[model samples]
Target: MASSSSNNTHGKNLRNAVVALLAPLPSIFFYLSFLRHYSAAAEAGSLSPLWTWCYHHPLLLANTLFFLNVNVLFWLIGVLQSSHWMIDLYWTMIPLLLIHYFSTHPLAQCNSWRSRLVILLTWVWSIRLTHSYFRREKWQWGAREDWRFSDMHQQYGQKWWWISFFAVYLAQQVFLMGICLPLYVVHSKDKQLNIWDLLASLVCLTGVTIAYFADTQLHNFVTRNERLKKLGQDLVPNLDEGLWQYSRHPNYFGEQLWWWGLVIFAWNLGCGWCFVGALVNSLCLAYVTILVEERMLKQQYRAEAYKNYRKRTSVWIPWFKTSLTGKEKET
Candidate 1:
């Protein structure tokens, strides 16, 4: 009976994974169809005024497509799954979608090298994040939702059903699209690759490397502690090694660096406004970091150790640890 139950769960997860894989197809089809029709109309000089406007303004079309797919289709999937876990998976994928959308659109007028470089970098970053996500999920698709979402579910009770549309899906649309505005700018602008491009690429790659290692370290720590728990031994209280030793949230910092690094590419292309998305994302991360720390302090076994770790660690940017005073040492 135990074996049977495990098999059932595996079957459900496999089915969910297949559905999640195909969920974005419709939106992608629509966008490509729109582009094809727009191109035909442009050549014949018979384009509708609104279609002409859309051709000139690709970001507007991108966001509208994103809304229909995420806000509508993804929400329905979440309602069916009774869990918003799918969106967490989509978070790593949407940027890859956006980059392709911008690069393939008729209006794409970017330097060939820069466009290809950004797309390649995005693929690398996406792969790393998706792998981290699956590892965090223990390779079980849709088995668990993020802890923060679970907290909100409890906080709002029945009201969460409606509130989740705004709080979860819509909020993600804003942040995801905002941070990805650089993709559009990168494709729209035709500046030649320069020294700044090299610098931006370096920064972006460094961020991905840092985030990859930090997540791996944190995952190993949690896994080891879980093993100890199973053995009825005392679990390690905190992760104060590797990247966590220098910063309370090195992963968040690394993520921000990656986004901001892309913004540098946009800035070099004369689209400084692209920074808005990365900036907003950082601000949201700040709130999330505070919430995470508060939750950590609530843990009986982890609170004392985490409190001391927080005192000596930088909140975001990594640096050498601060020395503890005599009073702090005694405590």
Candidate 2:
């Protein structure tokens, strides 16, 4: 019976793997069709109405099409596999793709030092975050979905099929676009690199490094704990060393800092409105994501170790100590 169950699991994974490989073809074909139509219109003096509309509102059209493609992909994959975590793979990737698209546009003046700097920093940050997700989530062609999404599957039952489309995929699409507004602002202007750009770069680099270390430490700890569990030994509920000791969510803090650094870059270029994206992103991280994650950890562990860590460590800021009463105290 165990062997039969293992074979069934392997068959399901193989099917998912095949679906994942083929799913992106439609999106790619749509993009290519657009490019072909646009090129033909450029050669001729007249364009089809659809192409004309796309040309007039390139960014809006492109982003909308991308979002549609993502939603379709996720919906189909989710329905087939009864899982929504496939969308998580693209969460960090879409921003980088958008920035690359804008930065490489003819009107973007990609040659400017400022544009190059933003592109470079964004690429570094995106690649690091994506790699971290790949490692931590084991997000290969056919991997287990995240536990959170699995729980949602159980909670929502049949309704989760459609709900995942909006709640999981579309919601993330909106957040991704909003958080990446600074990339648009940076690419829109042909500004020279300034002192503020240097400072922003430093801040972004520091945040990326901090996030990298935090994830590394956490991953190592989890690996060790799993090994100990296999040996029937007790496992640690939470990590309290290195950056984890300073902040309950150091990786999250680093992520916010990185986005804020991008905001600083745009603000220095006089794009005050772009700050809205950064502000909203930070608020969501603080009030929504961190809160949900911590609540889950608290429930799952229900141990004094995690509770004490929560009491002493700042939730979203590193080195800002918290009192037992849950009030912030300057360290």
Candidate 3:
């Protein structure tokens, strides 16, 4: 029994390591657009057509990389992390990956510099987020379900587990593919850089900064609030004490900005499908983030004080001059 458990754990560790190692490979191919007008320089006498095709069609490597780096690798994240919620993380990535494949032809888009830059930035973000999330969580694998999900399961009852699992899993897979459409298309196109790409990269950076700050602030708030609550004081404000003053979800705002920035980048590259596809992705993320995160915050607070904040704060869009839509002040 001991030997079997040890072997399992060792195998899991190997899998997670492999996943991490392969993390950045697929996006590389997706952004570079290696296949448009590809030709075999060598004479037919020297090399077979099949060999030449594979030689020039480097994106096939990316296709292989996807299965190795993403799809199959995520299973390892689940197995090694000991929490099925790791699977949730994996599910989240599916939408991003699929979005890339669907919105843009990986080999085609990478030809364009603007589109390629978008892919680079997107890949960087993914790698950073995935690594951070994996590292932060306890890796005991199956030891504990995420508390929020656990609570949800209890509320829903056992019958909902399978349904919930697949629902979220499938949704995330679809989402992953949808949002990443820009990079794939642009990279495959072999387009050039333009004004829009510059503007979009800035937008992406701004969104990332805002989202990072909001997330950090919220995490700190939760930690401090828990400590304060133990001593029995009125609940510490978790909402908009800082950037939250203007927007209910600073993080969501940033998140939306990032995707739109990608869209704009794709637009500069002259790819219609990628640009429009990224637009759809931006809309969905905004909707889901607001629904899931905003609702959770409101439910948790549920107070007259919170009502005041809600009334004053914009759900997402920042009010440039003032808060509360310039409506009457509430105490």
Candidate 4:
């Protein structure tokens, strides 16, 4: 029995490793092929005007590639898996890819400390997020889809097969590409590193650190509750300690800060338009937060506790709790 269990675990680990190594290849291949084809077409003067325009505009090219790779390819993969779980995994990876893509493009003009700093910070953010994702997933790939996607599946019924293309995958393309626009600006412009860059770096790093601790705390809380349930003990009603005490969703708050921090970099580079991405992301997160809180309230075991917790806690930003009577509560 022990030997069989050990072999099963080993098999699962090997399969996961293989999938990890291969999962990014398709996107990488598409990116390289895109650049190669663009070069050949440009050199031969065989490209149409629209294609030529895209070649000159790295942001446009990135979005086009994103459309094909994520909107089309990832959507198809999600259909095959009968789950949109893969997109959740890739969310932690896409920014990292975008940062590198912009920095390495033939038209890239960046070769400065700002570029290096942005890339390094992106790496840090990606690694931290990816690690949190895997930890939440118990190091398993695609074990279950996010609950919201599952809800949408049922809500949309048969229409989900098509609606998901736009609602899930395409919407993600818009948000992800938008939030990553700063990466393009960082690489496209050559600007001297300034106080703003220092400030942006600090904000980005702080966001990553806050998100790391918040997620760790939440995960530990959940794991402890699960263990208590198995031991036939009464489960904790709600998590209202640590960062959760100050805000209902510190993880989300941190994530918003990270993206907006990138926007600061672009804004300093004179592309304030990049704020659109961070703004859209914030709106999306606001919607998700509503859904999450609604779900929490529906849980009979902790509904009242969560309602009181909500009364006391700020929705996103960390702050001193409020009294149940809606006045500021001293912590």
On lDDT, the leading prediction is: 1
* Candidate 2 lDDT trough over 10 residues, lowest sum: 322-331
What is the C-alpha lDDT profile of model 4 across 1-331, one tens digit per residue?
9999978877866664565557667768866876787788868979766656756887877787778877887788778768877788889988999898888777889647888899999999999999998899888777678898999999999899889999888899889998998999999888788899999999999899899999999999999999999999999989999999999999999998999999999999999999999999999899999999999999899998887898878999999986565342332
Note the Cα lDDT for every prediction shown.
0.91, 0.76, 0.58, 0.86
Candidate 3 lDDT tens digits, 180-265: 55655565555556666679899988887787777767767776777888988867654666777778778778877887777776
Superposition error at 279 for model 4 (Å) = 0.8
TM-score of 2: 0.86
User: Where does candidate 4 clash, by residue pair?
Assistant: none
Question: Which clashing pairs does model 1 show?
Answer: none
TM-score for all predictions?
Answer: 0.95, 0.86, 0.64, 0.89
lDDT (Cα, 0-100) at 176 in candidate 3:
54
Ranked by lDDT, the better of candidates 1 and 2 is: 1
Candidate 1 Cα errors over 4 Å, as ranges: 38-54
Q: What shift in Å separates residue 242 of candidate 3 from its native position after superposition?
A: 2.5
TM-score of 3: 0.64
Which is better, 1 or 4, measured by lDDT? 1
Top-TM-score structure, candidate number: 1
Instruction: Give one digit per residue, the lDDT tens place, for model 2 in 1-331.
Output: 9999878877876776677656656656765676687777777868788767765675786577667678776677787777765667667767776776676543455337787777888889989988898788555544677666777778988888888877777777677778788888887766667789889999999899999999989899988988988999877777889998898788888888898898888888788787787788787777766556566466665455666677677886789665565243321
